[model samples]
Target: MNSLPDLLRLLAVPAFAWVAWRDIATRRVPDRVWLPLLLVAGVALLFEFFTINGSPTRRFFLVRVGLSAGLVVPLSYAFWRLGGFGGADAKAFIVLSVLFPAYPAYRLLEFSFPGVETALGIFSLTIVTNAVLVGIFYPVALAARNALAGEVSLRSFVARPIPAADATTEYGRLLDVGPGRGGLDLDALRMYLRWRGHTLEELRADRSTYRHSRSLPEERNPPGDGAIRTTAA
Candidate 1:
């Protein structure tokens, strides 16, 4: 009951759908599908070219195919770069040159038109629709993900100051330190230092002037009774 053109038209939807599915599942569309799709598009174009009456209409179809190819290739490349679509989608569009040689206008119309203005109008509308749908869906998906995960707090994003070096200091800020290993808090260390007649600010100002510095002394063994030793010059 169905004509050959009608069969081809129906076939185009499944072919494109398969391309989208394969890309979604494996991040790739197989060459088997793309190659046949390209060939089918070429055959469809050839069929349309000879079957249609008037030399002017044939030239129009060819011109539209050229324009659509030119537009779709670069635009698809941009989309691929943005992570919106993959290389397979662009190739699929190129194969569509057979089915929509004139494009947007050709897609909308059941029959060929004398002028290309209708095609241009349809192309513009298609672009606008795709843009709107992508914009709306992407943000909604991101929000849903963030809500499910529970967003990170602002305080967690900032880097805190390093702590001072001292064992006695009970640094609260360094309690749950993970990355750079823990150290004594300057404020807490200063409190401990103050108990021993020195302030933290004073030690920071001049390390060399400490009345009783807690720094470890260099090791120097005393001379043994049976060991040889050299006297200072």
Candidate 2:
């Protein structure tokens, strides 16, 4: 019974794993996923309070949980507002703060857990710190993912690679034919593609279609306006 709260909190790990997979695939998580975790954490916390037999111990528990939550919620919110965190990621952190307000220390089925803790022993903050530390390997992870899929692009770490046949339907900006692409100076070509509402692949499929346009947006003018009106070749 003494370890019930910690075990309940442990449920959050697998829940977050599902959330991470969903976030990577569709960037969406239904609100329903969090409510159950929150409910369990709340109920377990109340049970822990009731189980406590002394005033000082209960007060200490309250102080630990309250301080952990008070510190994490604001920091997660600030990161979300600054665009440094996704809204789902921010919510995950906040939920984690509630679920694990303080370190979980107990032996379960003969397996000792959390043999050591940070100086503060604030579990929520520890989770955040570990997340930041793990994030340092994200670039390497990206590179590896792209490599395994044979997406050996110069911008593989940051860009998504799709077949040229699906360029019109795919959701991403042109990387190979961007305005800033050097050598061939395809910037003008890029502007022309934008003005004509065409993808580079479409133009390349039949250059004769886009090579002779009725109007060409001047370099200084907005993409929609084609004041130059000289056959854009």
Candidate 3:
């Protein structure tokens, strides 16, 4: 409870969760988050080093910190380079390397807290492996769901179609409706509609105001252009 690493457990849990939520909402995390975190962690670490004078105790702490940081930081960067991890995610793990360094252990009644640790005893590595397991299982779960609903096959296994009415509220790309495009790509149509601060249903309802390729905010209609096909949007 008194150790810097143990105290940081409180900060690490909620901070990581908040970052995940922010990324989900806006698709990007601010670069500023790491700076303050690294500062506080650096100060605490320096403070702990001077305050602990016992040779064996400091050596044990340094060994764990060295092992955890040595393994986790490089692996996190490698995962990011290999495209398995996002930049924010890799940075988060690197922060975890400093914040944790080893599993934070404490006692409650007859049990140990956290209740999990890897064979190598690096806390950050445990998180990465757990994320990998979840990544593997998640698609299997989705595919099982589709199979039970009789939507079997690779396409349905990977993607489930959302209604056009609901599409405006969700985040995804439109799969091109085969042919009969009438010179309109659904991707371009949605971009133009979004730029105009409107929805597909709105454009569908009043094609007269948004009937041509001229409907895009900064784009002009070319010569001999035909009216936008209603089905195109």
- Give the winner by lDDT: 2
Q: How accurate is candidate 3 locally (lDDT)?
A: 0.69
What TM-scores do the predictions have?
0.49, 0.64, 0.73
Runs in model 2 lying further than 4 Å from the true structure = 137-177, 180-233
lDDT of 1 by residue, 1-233 (tens): 33344346556678777667655544445677877766666776677667768989777767776776676666666777886655676566556544555432233346653234553633423443465487668656665555556644443322233344433233234444457777444344444454444445666677676645554234423322211112311
Mind giving the per-residue lDDT tens digits that candidate 2 earns over 1-233?
Answer: 33777777777779888899776654557788888888877987887888878999899889988988898889889878987678888888888888888788778686777877887778889888777677667767777889999887667776666666655333335555567674222334444566666666867887775567443334533454212233221
Q: Rank the candidates by TM-score, best first.
A: 3, 2, 1
Best model number under TM-score:
3
For each candidate in the order shown, give its overall lDDT on alpha carbons. Answer: 0.53, 0.72, 0.69
Candidate 3's C-alpha runs over 4 A off are 1-4, 51-53, 174-192, 204-211, 217-233
Model 3 agreement with the true structure over 65-98: per-residue lDDT tens digits: 8987898899889989997788998998898888
In model 1, the number of clashes is 1
RMSD of each: 21.9, 10.1, 7.6
Better of 1 and 3 by lDDT: 3
